[model samples]
Target: MTTNILFCGDASMTDGVLIATLSLMKQTRHPLHIFILTATLTVNGHHYRPFAAGTAERMTKLMQTQNSAHQLTRIDITDLFVADLPRANMKTMFTPYCMLRLFSDLVPELPDRVLYLDTDVVCRRPFDTFYNQSMAGVDIAGVLDHYGKWWFHHRLAWFDYLNSGVLLMSLAHIREDGLLVRCRQLVRHRWLFMPDQSALNIKAKFKRILPRKYNEQHQLKPDTVFQHFTTFFRFWPYFRIVTVKPWQIQAVHQQLGLHEYDDLLKDYRQLAPKLKEVS
Candidate 1:
């Protein structure tokens, strides 16, 4: 069976997505059916460009190199986003593109089960075990946010708050229960700090909290499967938020001091120049 992976972002997220894809490809030999959801939107004066078709074409070719069955499909949800705009959170720190995953149920092409990953993540270990885990009654499966869990919980502070960066979604359950519809309504009408993540936490009826190894947001451990480069706060010298992504090769080497993915980084460096030509 092919693993259905999903990523949502705009054109600015191209490098992150490409590097994340490379990391996944290196870890597992399983047939991957990757779906990239992108959209063009103009909230206020800022215009966001959708993922380029040429980049998608290049990525499709790259995926097939590992396994003939591996495929990459780019789905543009411009019209859907235009119809149901998240008006309340449009001006938040996050771009409007971050809400794209909330429209996944409306996309006819998506599989019943899709693993949604944020662009700023790298796979360190094969996650077929996590991907193939039974989702019989769970609408979504995710790990607790390293930072958000302490403050953003719906009921129990640490137990209910889940990070949206790496989620194993049950699309069938979400559609049947109208989960995304409620999430969309919540974000469109109400202002949330982390709109999508908060809406999911509040509205999802059944969610499974996985081990931290599934989405290790902090320092990477030996058993970490997906290393998420999420923004975290540091208070030693002075209180400041740190943000770093896998695509930031120099930051990953210098700031993060991570050298485990040298092979993947080398491949990303070689392939990155071609993105400029495509864009």
Candidate 2:
């Protein structure tokens, strides 16, 4: 069966996306139907570049090399973005690209069920078990945020706040319940710490909490399937936030003290240079 995956980011996310793709390909031999959502926007005079067509073409070729049925499609949603602009949170620390996944329901090309992955995550094991899990009545399935679950509970004291980074979305259910529509409305009017993520937690009615292995945000464990390089808080030396992505090779080795993806990084180093020349 073809595994459908979705990613949303701007042009700057190319390196991370490439590295994430390589790591995922290494884990699974199934045909991957990858979709990247991007848009060119000018908010407050700062320009956001969309993924280049040439870059998409190059990535497509790379995927085909793994499996002939594997495909990468870049979809620009500039018009849709302008229609439902996140006015309240556009200027926040998070980039406008972070909100693109909110528009996925409106995009006709997306499959009914798709696994949405943040560009910063690296797949360490096959995800077919998680991807193929039944989503009969659930609008979305995700792992609880390592930090947000403790603080961002909406109504009940029990933590249900999920990280938006790795979401197994049931687009059909979302469309039926108008979950994305409500999320967009919430983000447009109210500004939250993490707008898109918070909106999802607040609006999604039926959500399934998966095991931490699906989105291991902290230190990698033996059972971790997707190692998410999310931000961490360090309070010992000085109060600071640490952010590390898979593409940052040196940081992965020295800062994180993790050498799990060294072979992948070596391959990335050899292949990444070609992305610049693609266009």
Best by TM-score: 2
- Misplaced by over 4 Å in model 2 are 237-239, 277-279
Q: Model 1 — TM-score against the truth?
A: 0.96
Residue 98 Cα positional deviation in candidate 1, in Å, after optimal superposition: 0.7
Show pairs that collide, candidate 1. Answer: none
The true-versus-predicted C-alpha distance at residue 242 of model 1, in Å, is 1.3
Clashing pairs in 2: none
lDDT of 2 by residue, 183-252 (tens): 9999899997798899999998899999999999988999999999999988877898999888888998
Candidate 1, residue 247: lDDT? 79
lDDT of 1 by residue, 45-110 (tens): 988888887888888887887788999999999999889888999999888888999999999999
Question: Residue 106 error for model 2, in Å?
Answer: 0.5
Give each model a TM-score: 0.96, 0.97
RMSD of 1: 1.3
In model 1, which runs have C-alpha deviations exceeding 4 angstroms? 276-279
